[model samples]
Target: MLKQIANLDQNSGNTFKLLTDETGCCGDSITPCKYVAAVPVANSVSAVVVKDRDGNNQTVTFAAAATTVKAIRDALVTAVNSVGYEDDGNVLPGISVETVSTNKVVTIVGELIVVSLTTSGGSVAATATCTEVGICEFYVEWGGGASKVLTVNGVNATLGDLTFATASAANVKSALEGAANWPSGAVATVVKNTDDSIFEITVTNAQSTVAFILDGLRLTRSNCIVDYV
Candidate 1:
């Protein structure tokens, strides 16, 4: 069976490019951008419990019945960072909250574990949990299906086992960007088309015919796409 792309080949000198649906040109081409997916907001009210590396617990509660996802994320970051604000001590001190991909994904710099997630007040929802071990494994593919199983982390993690929320594609982007194995100058990004409910990932590099796989799906020229999980 096909494995992670990294196992199939090396980063030999191939150039990675993004194709446009409107124009057939790869890279340096302007394609009329549309929304593949709208940012996923909180469907029901919820609460998220964050446990930092220090084992400190910070609870952020969301009461909005149907608020923008961005608002919830901002509240979470603010609550996690506030000092002497309330009984819930700062869950992540000295750890910066950095948001990527239009605030869809928020990472607590230095490492913070999401212990429990609960949604209540208006409606109950599952909490957002982070299983980040500072490691990520990706299978990148290219022309003729040449591929490789690339690993990047402090330790050896299970290949193709890393998973995250589909609404927050930035989680995937953050994982790839956080890893060290990605070739220099090669970067990964996510885009949403307004017309559909899909999230497409593109890796652009001056050199390297790049495509990758996560969660058993192959991201290639033929199918470099993602959807709400």
Candidate 2:
């Protein structure tokens, strides 16, 4: 858990450092906080590796979608923010991203930040362009070693018990959204993957405009996949 909130371990001392120019070394009073810059090429992608307080590492990525400078920069902002976005069940460490983007140049700052960019960190493609595949849409895998239970509205139930691999799509939807937990509704897409397998039980969906927090529903394993339910 390499989080930037510093001080969880009182013995660690004030281990916070501000960002400085690439030339200057750490522990210096600098103009900008510690950050990485990049200029991505067309159809390029980027990722940030962050550690939590307990030495847990999580990689956040901005798929190779952004083709414009501003779009890539903005996407970087979102990608960095997605650090500990999900997985609230485990309550992992946290960090923040803030900077000034001018002329489509973006800067990410934190005490200890490791950033990887495609094309050029400061020299990227004509911005970035591409359609995002995942954001609000989630798929429910019928099988594949996923043992998920749902707490709908308020009642807890075994998802696998109600639905099986041969179940119809309508029944799958009923089992997911119209569960006993109407107070906080759930959503899903019951389509078969390339292998016609159901590895993921359910996901936060984008099928409808009406979105809710999914009151009692939570995945202890893959909850970190999305922030909003």
Q: TM-score for each prediction?
A: 0.27, 0.27
- Sequence-dependent TM-score of model 2: 0.27
Candidate 2 minimal-lDDT segment of 10 residues = 85-94
- For each candidate in the order shown, give its overall lDDT on alpha carbons: 0.37, 0.40
Q: Model 1 Cα displacement at 80 (Å)?
A: 1.3
Error of 2 at 202 (Å): 61
lDDT of 2 by residue, 9-106 (tens): 23323333221222255644312123334432333445545544345755666665565656665665566434422111222122222233433344
Q: Which portions of model 1 show Cα errors greater than 4 Å?
A: 1-42, 52-58, 62-66, 83-109, 120-229
Backbone-clash count (model 1): 22
Query: After superposition, which runs of candidate 2 have C-alpha atoms over 4 Å from their true positions?
Result: 1-32, 40-43, 55-57, 84-106, 118-229
